[model samples]
Target: MASIFSKIIDGEIPGQLLWTDAVCGVLLDIEPLTPGHALVVPRAEIDHWLDLPGETLAHLMDVAARVGRAQQEVFAAARVGMIIQGFEVPHAHLHVFPANSASDFELSRRSSRTPEQLAQDADALRAALRTQSDGAHVPGEA
Candidate 1:
């Protein structure tokens, strides 16, 4: 069976996508630790981050760094946090979010966002990405 992340990447379900490239996609988390929390997931349904090819792993990190930069700018975050906790979803993914302090890293602190709020957050991050050097990876951009 396909993992939920694969379903989202394949468009079987809706995702508030911020960036999409041949290798991976970056999208806002429905359950976010902060206003701009997002996920950097590879297009392939790799079950563990450790099992991914070196090139794919590098690409995911590159994408995460891009999203983190945008998150900092858009959210005015003191720092950007990233984690590779694969317990929640079988498919490997990195959670990237804006952080002000160490406490912001707690996964238990994540909270749900309404569809409207998610859209607003997505719009803000997408706009911020447009101004970034990696802006070309953002969907619907020139």
Candidate 2:
């Protein structure tokens, strides 16, 4: 069975996508610790982060860094937090969110947002990401 993230990547389910490449995709988290939170996920369904191939893991982190940079700028965050807590979903993913302090990194702090709210957050991050990169990874980019 495909993981929920796989379903989102495959278009079987909707995802507020921000970036995509051959190896991975970035999407806004519905249950976010803060606005502009994103998940950098590999296209392959590897359940454990440590199990991913070196280059593949590197690519995911590289993408997460990009999202973190954008989050810092757009959200005016003092720091960007990242974590690999795979319990929520079986597919391995990194949670990247704007953090003003260490406490912002807590996974138990996640809060749900309506689809409209998530879309608004995605739009803000997507616009910020477009300004920093080639803009190719941003959704609806031409």
Candidate 3:
């Protein structure tokens, strides 16, 4: 069975995608800890982060760092956070978000945003990513 993340990646379901590459995709979280919260997920549905090959893991981190940088710049975040909690979905993923304090790491505090808000956030991140680098991996800009 395809994981929800896989479905989103495959366009089986709607997702607020911010970046995409051969290895992984970055998308805004529906239930976000902060306004620019995003997830870095591999295309392969490895259940645990440890199970991923070293090269795949490295690629995911690289993408995550890029997204983190964009999030910080776009949100004026004090700091950026990355967490690997595979319990929510069986697929491996890194939760990257703008963090102002330790409290921002609390998963229970996630808030829901309407589709319109998510689309706006995605657009902002895409625009920021385009200006930050070559943006070869950003969907529309690439």
Best by TM-score: 3
| Model 1: per-residue Cα lDDT over 1-142, one tens digit each | 9888777776789988988889998888999999999999998898899999999999999889988999999899999999998999888999999999999999889999999999889888898888887478787543
Worst 10 residues of 2 by lDDT: 133-142
List RMSD in Å for every model shown.
Answer: 1.3, 1.1, 1.0
* Steric overlap count per candidate: 0, 0, 0
Pick by lDDT: 2 or 3, better one: 3
C-alpha lDDT of all candidate models, in order: 0.89, 0.89, 0.92
lDDT of 3 at 38: 95
Best by lDDT: 3
Q: 1-142, model 3: which lDDT tens digit per residue?
A: 9999988887789998888888998888999999999999999999999999999999999988889999999999999999999899999999999999999999899999999999989999999998888888787644
Worst 10 residues of 1 by lDDT: 133-142
Pairs of residues at least 3 apart in sequence or in different chains that clash in candidate 2 = none
After superposition, the stretches of candidate 3 with alpha carbons farther than 4 Å from their true spots are: none
For residues 19-121, write the lDDT of model 2, one tens digit per residue. Answer: 9888998988988998889999999999999999999999998899999999999899999999898988989999999999988987788899999998888
Off by over 4 Å in 2: none
Quote the positional error of residue 16 for candidate 3 in Å. 0.6
Distance from true position, residue 104, model 2, in Å?
0.8
Q: What is the TM-score of each candidate against the true structure?
A: 0.94, 0.95, 0.96
